[model samples]
Target: MTDLERDHSEPPDCLSIVSQVTNSTRAGKRERLAGAAVRVLHEQGVEKTTLADIARAADVPVGNVYYYFKTKDQLIEAAIEAHGHHLQTMLDELGRLAEPQDRLKALLRGWIGERDLTAQYGCPTGTLASELDKRDDGLDRAIAKVMGRLLAWVEEQFAAMGRTDAKELAVALFASYQGVALLTNTFRDPDLMATEGARLERWIDSLT
Candidate 1:
């Protein structure tokens, strides 16, 4: 029998297939909405971005957004969690480098690679953290925790390099990065980020 005829004879689990497809579509919509929220929030700041803005960015209907995220705050929280997960994944990948100094340089390189975007929107995590800090709510604390994780990871790298002042070094590194990010955004100069990133890389080498 032909494949179509065999399928007709067998009568596949149509309900199961339909259920799986529906669930998959729901998951896709949610992920798209969350991703769009992150981009919009990063570019527009959380206070200025509305649910409709996110829906437009996601290509999901505004009504459908409520089906996934009940409120704007919910979407913001989801975006924060998404950023946290992404940060953890990046740190985990950087952790694979054999030399701690190489891992630090790799991070600077990764940031430099995104220089254009950073020039346009500022550092994604840093900008979000600064905006959320004004909220003085649970989200402020949530984003703070995300930044703290990054600081802790950098400190670990410095500690691994046999530096007794690992925490201080981590703070200084992040401060420099955040400062450069602000200036890059202010001037719309991606090259500035590249230059500063190289300087930071050299500084990292000097420490090692």
Candidate 2:
């Protein structure tokens, strides 16, 4: 038998060519599956999404999906992780801003701009959190963890402004902005964000 066939006949080993191929295939499938989830989650709320939907969206067999993700919750967690990484990259860029308030303002403005792009589609994690509430505790926790990172970053910025209760202030700011975006989306009026955002900018200016 050839060396390749000999390696395959042997017991499981990390260095085996067959093992390497299996790992590569698994990784590629995961990447495609994650991409499908992102697209569907952005276009449709989690409540409206299903494993079959993801499988079809990914152009993979339904049973094939089980080979990679044992449960829908696992897929959702992976999608959330991908989004968290993306948001972290955005935060890293914003962190480079010299002024604290400037960093905060840029962060807020960037979020609003992103919402405008998907105003019709709705926020990814926001929609998932709303739909998965009480339905899947694990998914709820995952979404909360991602949102907590954003909240923590905001609080850090407020603390830089010398606020004694930075966490509370950050929560208030997030609440206000979420309300504005929710109202804007509900009314189908994009200007609501721009108008209210300017007011928020003025308020932040007064802080320093």
| Each prediction's whole-model lDDT (CA) | 0.86, 0.76
Which regions of candidate 1 fall more than 4 Å away from where they truly are?
1-26
RMSD of each: 8.1, 5.6
Ten consecutive residues with minimal summed lDDT in candidate 2?
A: 7-16
Q: Work out the TM-score per prediction.
A: 0.87, 0.81
Candidate 1 per-residue lDDT, tens place, 1-66, comes to 135335432222233445346564544666677788889999999988888999999998888777
**For model 1, the run of ten residues with the poorest summed lDDT:** 7-16
Q: Write the per-residue lDDT of candidate 2 for residues 1-208, one digit (tens) a residue.
A: 2464454323233344655466644445565777789878877777788888998988888888776677788888778887888889989999999888999899778767866743566566666666777683578888888889988999999999999988888998877777776677677777777787778888888888
**Could you say which candidate leads in lDDT?**
1
State the lDDT at 64 in candidate 2: 80
Model 2, position 21: C-alpha lDDT score: 67
TM-score of 1: 0.87
Off by over 4 Å in 2: 1-27
